[model samples]
Target: MTRFLPPVTIALAALVLWQLVSFIAGSHSVSGVVETMAYLFRMMQQESFWLDVAESGTAIFYAICLSMLFGWALGVVIGLNRNVSDVSEPILVTFYSLPKVTLYPLVLLLFGLGLSAKVAFGVMHGLVPICLITGNAIRQLRPVYIRTAKVMRLSRSSVTFHVVLPAILPELISSLRIGLSLSILGVLIGEMFASKRGLGFAAVNAMGLGDGTRIMAIGVFLSVCAISINFLLLEIESAIRHRTARI
Candidate 1:
């Protein structure tokens, strides 16, 4: 009971404040929590809503898989070498700092205005932070661990599999959680820009029709999805950390 009290209290307070503001405005331009929830319930009954969610979810899934595969591998390679990290770190940081949305035009040109474009856009957006976070985590490994690997005369693959990966599992999992959220955001952004189907486009359509309740409903749904994923990932990370400690 105590563990959940704070968040439940804050959520209730926020809903009350939102209702108060919406009542004061007395316009359809803003929706109260109750109205939004009502709209969300209606929307969930529609097959189209599920289709849009599925489309966005698919794009996000593919994008995250690609980003994690390439980003983790590159991070490990660069992180294990001081010279490579020194040369590549600045470049990676520069790319990470850039507005990834600006590259959407180029990605669209390369992949066309289709599923490929959305996946590519999302991968680019998510890849940077994962790569950087993983690199930093790897670089932080204790010198004693490195010495132990060398003392064992372990091959590169053996070292990575048996030592480096386990040591960095917690930080890497956290990075993956962040990466998943960013990938979803990226996919939604791409869908809003060009796709015929996706939750983002659904929200955009609602906006054009001046259906504030529907727009808010979509936003709330997306927020809930993101929060759920984050919570699940956190639990998995926590479990791994506890197991690692026990080992």
Candidate 2:
């Protein structure tokens, strides 16, 4: 399937290119592909590594869920009103463009530099993309659907849940993919800036100590973690879409 082959092909090509470049450069700064991969395998054997991975994963999941829930609700509200959407567009653009990391200090002060702060930071970054995408998708929904639903005397909740939500789901899934990637990056950076233990923390420490192997290893580990989560989410999204379509 193209779905599966594309990732595998890209991954293989990247690995070959990386190995060639690392080999030719002869500088130990960037690790060779094989060495980094071996280190990643070693990391998988450690219970503590999985625990740290789990911590970051849990925080990311919570943040994304909160972001999507709030964003979708707000987007529907704003999108339903032309005047409100127009007035808020500039403000929303500013928030989206601003770097989320800049607010970490304030968040740290409020949430005290723990999982909560990391999760909150992730939410800020994730919510903007989701909200914008959702709003845009809402605007494209057919007026005919609304008219027909009204003529049929559909309840407000029924119209929204049955019609609006289903129509926008494909777009929501796309936004969700983007939001997940951004949240993962945000969570890792948040961990680097503030956490005691995480893959990001390990990478940071490795960099400071000039442990090039560990640095490369941790980078690979993070990549694998990100890839796995993305794949899992994609699978879940596909399954849900199929089930919903059948209904």
Candidate 3:
């Protein structure tokens, strides 16, 4: 209860602000909290809503898996060699700084429409932060750690699982949290631009129809989901840090 209080308070405050804004802007421009929540509840009861959710969820899952796997592998490889890290870091940073939306046309051309496009967009958004964070964390790892692993004659797999992973677990989790959010954003953008299905498409359709209530409801729903997942990730990271500290 205590742990949840701050967020609850913040949510209430945000609601009050939202209602105030809606009142000032008039209902035509912005939906009230109650109205949006009602719409969201109704939306959840519809079969089409669930279908959109399933479509988006599948894409998000695939994107996250690929992003984490490839990002971690690349990060580890780069971090293990100072020369590689120095050479690649600037290029990676430059790419990451690019506005991803600008590349959407290219992505569409490569993957075409549907799940593949959505997943690719998501991977594009998610892959960099994880790689950058993981690589920096690895670079910061004490030299003694690697020397000790080598001295013990540990196999490559064993060393990675026992030493490298544990040492960078906290940073990895942080990267994951960021990557997950970006991946979701990317998928939604893909849906809005290139796909006929998913929550993003629904939101875009709502916008086209001037259905402000539906748009607000979708925004509220996505916000709640993102916040909940982020909170869970933070808790897990904290627990891991505590356990690591004890060890």
Which candidate number would show the highest lDDT if scored against the true structure? 3
Q: Once superposed on the true structure, which residue ranges of model 1 sit more than 4 Å away at CA?
A: none
Error of 3 at 33 (Å): 0.8
Taking all chains together, the TM-score of candidate 3 against the true structure is: 0.96
lDDT of 3 at 138: 90
RMSD of each: 1.3, 2.5, 1.2
True lDDT of residue 27, candidate 1: 43
Candidate 3 deviant stretches above 4 angstroms:
1-3
Tens digits of per-residue lDDT for model 2 on 181-208? Answer: 8888888889889898767787788788
Clashing pairs in 3: none
Which window of ten consecutive residues has the lowest lDDT sum in model 2? 25-34
lDDT of each: 0.89, 0.84, 0.92
Cα deviation in Å at residue 71, candidate 2? Answer: 1.4
Cα lDDT of candidate 2 equals 0.84
Per-residue lDDT of model 3, residues 23-99, tens digit only? 99998899998889998999999999999999999999999999999999888888777999999999999988899
Clashing pairs in 1: none
Ranked by lDDT, the better of candidates 2 and 3 is 3
Candidate 1 achieves a global lDDT of: 0.89
